[model samples]
Target: MPDDARLLSHPFDDDKLREECGIFGVIGVVDAAQFVALGLHALQHRGQEAGGIVTYAPEVGFASARRFGYVRDSFTKASVIETLPGSLGIGHVRYSTAGSKGQTQIRDVQPLFAEFAMGGCAIAHNGNITNAVALKRELIERGSIFQSSSDTECIIHLMARSIQSNIPERIKDALRRVEGAFSIVAMTRSKLIGVRDPLGVRPLMLGRVGDGFALASETCAFDIIGAEFLREVEPGEMVIITADGVESFFPFERQRPRFCVFEHVYFSRPDSVIGGKSVYETRRRIGVELAREAPVEADLVCPVPDSGTPAAIGYSQESGIPYAMGIIRNQYVGRTFIEPAEHIRNMGVRLKLNVNRALIRGKRIVLVDDSVVRGTTSRKIKEMILDAGAREVHFRIASPPTQWPCFYGVDTPEKDKLLASTMSEEQMRAHLGVDSLRFVSLDGLYRAAGEENGRDDARPQYCDACFSGDYPVSPADMIERGFQLKRSA
Candidate 1:
């Protein structure tokens, strides 16, 4: 795994410290595969490494094509998109969390195929399965052959052996046995199914375009096709959309909603609305709260860029400070920029973001950023600002400190790798070499989210697992077990 602290060398890391996969499915469309391709293009920000689309026509059977590259690079020509012809399709964009070494190839591209007793099923999943290794072992013991090393493959295996006759029932049964965050879109010969785990740790929304129904990780994808923004797929709910129309089932007992808070703070596009709350507004509120909680007398307030822009605007509005773009990011730098040597990686930050010396010279600046995971990039950013002749630099974090690793889809590192997990606020301030540093309180974050005094059974509870160590699902020795087994073998 890459160093979590060093991940911020790339622009994508600044948007969200954690990485997540995106899944899109459409049913009842003339050019379903082409629509899925366009939808994945809109959601390319969610994941950039690999792209795949699976189409089912029933007469021609199921056809899948995928490539190991950005969606544009993978399928740019009209011919590539037109080749995947079907009325129902599912697409996926992936950023590997585990087994990313050799699996970066096209063979590992998703909408993985499984030939079951019923028929062929293709699945595209977002979020990690905490019990995948154990489940895979158990399934392998039962003589189930595996293909991909992705944790997502386990779900299909479980679905294949389910007692239910129909695909939807089988999927529902399989979901009941899984114990982690998963928002999945599956396509069989005749049906398309969408399911979210009981404790929704990821965002999944349903949309409509004409008579067709679409499901995507975020609403941003829906905007591309002018899909009507229907209500969110409920946590623990399974909705099957086919020629019969949309039908929902809650097969399992409901658990408390644990929607990933990082979605609003970082992962989601600013235009997206998750669980009835606007992501842009939520992040702006976090900035507002941060300013109120930790006010600083500064000459100017500057954002880290992109993700930090909204929060910086809010902070500037709340603090009566002038906001300026102190750091300019180079949009062209891709994932390859971070692959160089140490001195090159150090210089990579400058390539990605350059300080506007004129904006900061002799000014006391308050730097507003979303969150600081591993403090390496934060420390370097502060140094760059100081080097630009800023009189003083005070850092304000919009979200609370991330002290724990996320085992649910996100690529956060172990607890010890997190700067906040070990350092106190003052200690972090000293480490980053800033004049002062303060983080938003957990309560303040909830209050800003307008769920401070939320009822015990709210439908859209926030997932603060990274802030607080209260993980919705415990992955107990899974990480250790996998690493240990790999080492021993």
Candidate 2:
């Protein structure tokens, strides 16, 4: 949903950046849609707007179900899963970065299927297409009709126009004309396919389940269905999974890989692994780095709950400050809860998190959080802590300030909407009305992610563009729409 409409949805999570989608697929597995549903449930945190599953079986042909809500809400029922029985299936949990945003319609839900000259294929995409508007215009002029507003539909139209002899070749042909990040899970009757863009701006993992195979946005999804963690689907690489086994190919011209760094700080489930590193360990290391960079005199280190808990533990362990859950999250305050009046709406974060007044009162508290985007939540949280009679509040952010909007897939506010874009660290501290505020440096973040030398400006390792404004791939659509890039230093 858009920022304004978030008040009606989940206002507690609005200040944070959100990844747009999560995809999972399985091949050579009986009841693949059921496996896909479990995978999507594990990945629900990445996207909660809607979910869809498409499966192909010889007897039933193709079956699809897309519903506007959680996977648990829609795909769990026997009525829905029975209709989608197949040995090859693909599914998506969506949070709309490329399409209609908050206005997600059933048509926008994915596992978008189409029949082509070769046969029928369905795709579940997990990233954004930067040149979609231009390609969409060209395709429309060339007589390609679009259904949903999703940029991923452009790939379908492009594949339709391609003269390629097969679906995989047509996929490569279509991707060659498109720009930006993508980690796709697509399925034909006999084949389940996975591919990542040249930069690998998003994550996709390959897993093994007995003799069959799985592709997921994270290893946590693999964990949910008892699949063995294999390796990541490499950047610029494609894997075709069938009854025989898996065949790998590099369909795109390889560039220096720039996987999204924010996945470690947020987005991915803590239990997930990326590039052989545990997301939880990376976040803990981030806290270690943050404590080393910015230590403060606080009685207790407290996490903002859930997202900040691991980092807070690391901070406490490193700083010798006892860790406590100062703010308790209401585990059941779902997005469906309605605050019908202005006053009720104003009680924003209070609805989701309440300060542990007994633990917080009279303490000089250190509140650790993943990142501060607009600082609205930070301000509200600080107020709550102060009202609980805390003497002072210090904030330690896991990631560096988000200074730019993400074009590759993450749903972020415009540059100006980012508090860090217009304010210095000290200014943000003043704005949040905290005793002090510090964010992990970009290099510090890189070090925590296993880069010993930290970020290499000459040849950077990962995508920290949200913090640094150094986009690995030019965002073609935004540039065309008149969004300015950061001037070189």
Candidate 3:
């Protein structure tokens, strides 16, 4: 195991921390690596920090190329893409939640490789593994060597030790041993396997292209490859694609599906379908419900930016208020801004979003946003609206309050930093200096999902832990253990 000292320090600057990871795998194709590269390009919105691809051609065992920047920067050149050749492949686009800024160099880009008694395995993962620290300790004690600090690497070690007869069985054994949210795509000599946790905390979908099969974190990837939308990979299920064809395995007894609700509200592309509901439709319905639940007399409805635009339209339609582009976002600014000093860091928000005074001047405005994580950005936006000559600014959140931290892939703040965790709605309203503040109710959020009981086919229940504080997995003891480990370090 390598000493990963950078993990102790915060690496990401404030501006570049808003995206999730994406994974793609393909089997039984002539140019699988090239096709996977194209698929990753389409799903680039999910992650932008780093990108890589690993392919196993008949002549070549496992040829891999990875870089510390965007997918286009890494593999778009003719020289880079043409070099990779394989019929089985896996790819990853990463946004670091594990290693620090120093570790974010190329060494951290994944499809982490490990060789064992059974041969070799390459894994690309899209979600966080909560029990990783504990698991890594156990593996290290057993003499397993680790190349990276990423939690994804933990699964490779687990698979190497399992007594299963084949790769799929070994993978199933490894999954049963680990815990937390993970939507993984792993490739071996002859197989491409996709696995999802029992709670289904992250989204993973299956698609078919001609005679081949594909697996990705979102359907948007499928759109790029012209693959027909097959159904989602069921929670706790593992599907293995080989030359023989596709085979499904349910290694663990089934558990309730706790699909991450945030995916529909914020993370996923609006055009994608998650847990059977269209992301766009769900956000629109959230707007409709927010208008019904928190109606206010306002001259116009203005969205915070890209993610809030759909819900703002819905709010306008349901409330009979006109929708206007009151705020414009500078799309060219790449997720991070250049700040020479600590005093100027807050200015990043201004560079990202601005108020169009002509549309908002002298009017009562209804401001819509997807979620308020820390409330700092929300507070700033409200003040900007007030300064733009708005008579009043009433804030409407499209989703239920996020009161709990997510142990899954979403890098949510600690419980103490969450605004809703400590303060009442009235307290939060005063803190933000808004004329009024209201959030969509939990029941209303489910209803807006348009499912009879919020269960769409496979997932009969939703993961409302952030709003309800009823986690599917026990986090009380885990949090204490994590804290103790941090103190020891």
Reference-based lDDT, residue 170, model 2: 94
- Tens-digit lDDT string for candidate 1 (337-449): 65646566557467678999998999999998888988877887898999999999999988889887788888777677889889998899989899999988887777667
Query: Local error of candidate 1 at 383, Å?
Result: 1.4
Give lDDT: candidate 3, residue 148.
81
Q: Give the TM-score of candidate 2.
A: 0.98
lDDT of 3 by residue, 1-489 (tens): 011221122212241124458999998888888789988987787777788899887676888899766677778887887778888899998776555444566767878877667767888888777788888998999998887878877888898888877777787888887878889999999999999988888888999977889999899889988888899999988998888888898877788788877787888889899867789989999999999999999999999888888899999999999999999998766543443344544464676788999889999999999988678778888888988999999999998888877767766666777888889999999999999999998877888876546434334477766776666665533575753221221
Write the number of the candidate with greater lDDT, choosing between 1 and 3. 1
Model 3 scores a TM of 0.91
| TM-score on alpha carbons, each prediction | 0.93, 0.98, 0.91
**Can you write out model 2's per-residue Cα lDDT over 153-261, one digit (the tens) per residue?**
9999999989989999999999999899999999998999999999998999999997899999999999989999989999999999989999999987879999999
Model 2: CA > 4 A from native: 97-102, 339-342
Q: Against the true structure, candidate 1 has what lDDT? A: 0.82
Point out where model 3 deviates above 4 Å: 1-19, 339-344, 452-460, 482-489
